[model samples]
Target: MLKLFRSAASIAALILGIAGVFLVLYAWRLPPFTGTVQTTDNAYVRGQVTIISPQLAGYLAEVAVQDFQHVKAGQVLVKIDDRIFEQKLQQAKATLASQQAALANSEQKRRSDEARIASSKAQVDSAKAALTAAEANWKRIEPLLERGVTTQSQADQARASLDQATAALHQADAAEEVARQDLTSTLVNRQSLEAAVQSAEAAVHLAEIDLQNTRIVAPQDGRLGEVGARVGQYVAAGTQLMALVPEKVWVIANFKETQLAGMKVGQPVTFTVDALQHAELTGHIERFSPAAGSEFSVLRADNATGNFTKVAQRVPVRIAIDPNQPLAERLAPGMSVIVSADTSTAASDVPATGTAPGATPPAQVSEQ
Candidate 1:
């Protein structure tokens, strides 16, 4: 009976050892067993989130949209107390009108000054002509007096007339100088008036901008988030009013570096969203992050100063949803997901090496 028991024990040990060897062989990807594809649940849906904030400080007069309400781009989402803004606009317009009126008055003054200058110039010409005639008469009379052809009194009278004409010419010159100076001053004043007008115009423009700010509009077509703002709520500039989640969404998958050997852009991907039951979505690899996920961490690991251990770091891969097979229309961001990538086929249609035509190196993204 002892010999029989020993033989049975030996047979049992041999069978168990044989089974262990087969399991190791299978785990090691030996013959008769294929390697499983890389898969992970470290993925999520992501998109741009718009944070609506007030650009100007005012009391909220109206809140047009509610939480989860669909809004079209450029639709009015909120209205601030516009009375102040409207008054500012009206004052700015009035100032602009007054400035324009002043400018018109300056223009009229400029014309009047020009006319005065022209009249002064004519007077100077007339004075010059009279001086010329008086000097000619005095010369003729002086020669006549020397030749005894005219009396001394007549020559004296001609001399006095010449003197008078010279005084008149001097007065004309003084008047012309005054007119020219006045004209110069008027031109300078016109410049000041024009500047005032421009300033008023700028004020009006700023007022209009403020008025437009009173009516906040949605920037994109999306669903509204929690409506934290309410009517009569006093808010300051840059205050958060609400949020918007856009309709377009995509997946971000972090895959282990070891599993990235066969991953490439344009390769098909299958993922299941946690929010959806018994449903799956299909997409294609869009791009790969230039660095591993740890690189973006706030406190990144510094292997240079620490004892190093081999770690399978994960890299972020951007996967674009096939527009036709995108997540549900109501799906939002931050949703959890599981991703599976097939390595059996290559994406020959795309430049998986990140060297597409006209594409810059990954480092250029930081610069952009």
Candidate 2:
């Protein structure tokens, strides 16, 4: 009876061992996976904060905004001592007025020159008519002198009168030519003065722009932060006086290179920030860095050394959150967030059978 019992026990042990082996083999055939990267207690929120500075240097006169104040776009943030700017603007206006007057005077002078030219042309015509009459008189006297009907003295006087009239006519013609040249030159001078007036006007416009800039205004609607300037402070150009935090904010997650295998653009991402434990925000993967984080470092690691050990790289992935969240629950930039993207969505979104351009068709199942 003891030998029979030992044989039955041996058979039972063999059957149990075979069953365990089969279970191990079955578990090995499942899909591969790894533990997700996450953090429950550590993270930071971050976003873009614009540095508020003056484009022009001046003494700060009035600080229009208080610390941590909310401001709308184009609201006056600060007022520099605009006294100097105002004086400059006044001086520019005065200069432009002066230039405009000069231009008007130049135009008036040009008109006067034109009038002189017209009068000169009339005088030239009168002189030409007088010369013609004198020549005819001299011709009639020549016929008389040839017939001895006119005395030599009379003929000589007539010739002298004709010469005098010719000289006067030539003088008038020269005067007319001078007047015409003067008119042309005056027109040119008027055009030049007009150009000067235009230039002066441009200077005035620039001065006005500068004056407007003296009243510093917010470029966008944002929250005020880090108010470093005070009333009566002398701020230089490009000096930072405060900071403006915009309402828009999002998260940047650095994921392990191995974790990105299933990560893809447009994948749905769920994030948890340490500060707001109860707040769950949904975002989508916008993009991932093409290169590893180490590659972008100033001194990248050289793996050429034979003694070097391999390390998995981490890549930066940008995830944008839904914009429809409540104002109270909006995420601020630089806030740490634990991110998880579901790449399995690609399976349903992608066509299973149709082949995309430049891609091979997916495998089709066959009924066996």
Task: State every prediction's TM-score relative to the real structure.
Answer: 0.87, 0.80
Best by lDDT: 1
For candidate 1, report its TM-score: 0.87
lDDT of 1: 0.86
Query: Which is the leading candidate under TM-score?
Result: 1
Question: Model 2, which residues run further than 4 Å from truth?
Answer: 1-31, 35-44, 290-309, 347-368
Give the per-residue lDDT digits (tens) of candidate 2, residues 1-368: 99999999999999999777766765442223233332222234556798999978889999988888989999999988988888989999999899899888887888888888888888889888888988999999999999999999999999998998898889888988898888888888878888888988898999999899889889888888968889989999899999998776666777765566655555667777766775677876665555667888999777897698778677677666767766325566666677766756764663342322223445752111
lDDT of model 1 at position 29: 46
In candidate 1, which residue ranges exceed 4 Å CA deviation? 1-36, 351-368
Residue 105 lDDT, candidate 2, scale 0-100: 85
lDDT of each: 0.86, 0.75
Q: After superposition, how far is residue 239 of candidate 2 from its true place, in Å?
A: 0.2
